[model samples]
Target: MVKVTFHQDPVTLVGNEVKVGDNAPDFNVLTNDLGIKSLADYQGKIKLISVVPSIDTGVCSIQTNRFNEEAKELENVSVITVSMDLPFAQKRWREVNNVEDLELLSDHRDADFGEKYGVLIKELRLLARSIFVIDSNDKVTYVEYVHEVSEHPDYDKALEEAEKAE
Candidate 1:
């Protein structure tokens, strides 16, 4: 378990924290259409899994948008944002923000992704800010668990790792 802080207050994170060279955990999350999606669904492609507490917040919105833009330039990579927000809210946010390139996934159904990735914030029922880059073979190449939930992740580093992963 990783010690995560939201606004300076420590929060407990559930599940094992993924590390570089570990096989990316496979978990189910809800797509905008209420369809079940799993890491295996995106097999054979590099994945950029962006975790945020809520997509509606300022930092989360900025993080998603930043990755949305970068997703367009990255070849053979899928950018996915996971949050505890409901599918309805995620859909609305995507439409309101005009997000097109990345997939907005909801962990509201079961928190499977949140728990499996070790980003689940026990007190808030939200995911702590983090970024994971998985290579085509499903091995994690980069993992960034942001110490502060309210802060943004290292976008450049994650993107670089995704691009470098073979």
Candidate 2:
């Protein structure tokens, strides 16, 4: 388990911590249309998984928007943002923010992604900020567990890894 902090206070993260060279865990997340999306659905494509507590917050919004912008330039890569926010809220946020490139998925159904990826904050029932890059074969090539939940991740490094994986 990784020690994560929200607002600079230590918090416990639930589930196994994924590392580079490990096979990416399969989990269920909800698409904007309330359909179930699994890791298997993204097979054969490099994946950039951006985990955030919620898309409604300032930092989370910036993180998602940044990746959404970068997703436009990347080829053979699927950028997905996972959060504990409800599908309804995610849909509205996408519409309001006009985010078109990145896919926004919800972990509200079972926290399946949150637990499998080890980003779930036990106390808050939200995900801690993190980034993961998975190659086309579904092997994790890069993993960054952000120390502070409110802060942004290493965008350059994560994006670079994703590009290299492609």
Estimated TM-score per prediction? Answer: 0.98, 0.98
**Best candidate, lDDT:** 2
Instruction: Tell me the tens digit of each residue's lDDT in model 2 across 1-166.
Output: 6778999999989999999999999999999899999999999999999999999999999999999999999999999999999999999999999999999999998999988988899999999999999999999999999999998999999999999995
The lDDT per prediction is 0.94, 0.95
Model 1 agreement with the true structure over 84-129: per-residue lDDT tens digits: 9999999999999999999999999899999999999899899999
Lowest summed lDDT window (length 10), candidate 2? 1-10
RMSD of 1: 0.7
- Residue pairs with colliding backbones in model 2 are none
Q: For candidate 1, give the lDDT of residue 75.
A: 97
lDDT of 2: 0.95
Error of 2 at 154 (Å): 0.7
